[model samples]
Target: MGNGLIYVMAVNIVIWIGIAFYLFSLDRKIKKLEREMNDPSH
Candidate 1:
């Protein structure tokens, strides 16, 4: 039972880390697009 709990915790941690990275990258992309839209040369 203890080992199972550890596995669950590890999985959850990994999932959260992945989600955080995905959000970070997504934010960067959105910001870049916004910059492009605001430029007159674009």
Candidate 2:
């Protein structure tokens, strides 16, 4: 039972980590697009 719980928890942790990375990258891309829009060169 304890081992099964640990595996479940680990899978949850991995999913959350992937989500966090995706969100971070999305934020970075948004910021870059905003900068490009505001820049005179574009």
> Candidate 1: global Cα-lDDT?
0.95
1-42 in candidate 2: lDDT tens per residue? 687999999999999999999999999999999999899697
Backbone N/Cα/C clashes per model: 0, 0
Local distance difference test scores for all models:
0.95, 0.96
Which residue pairs does candidate 2 place in steric collision? none
lDDT of 1 by residue, 1-42 (tens): 697999999999999999999999999999999999899597
**In model 1, how large is the Cα lDDT of residue 19?**
100
Lowest lDDT 10-mer window, candidate 2? 1-10
lDDT of 1 at 3: 70
List residue ranges in candidate 2 displaced over 4 A. Answer: none
Clashing pairs in 1: none
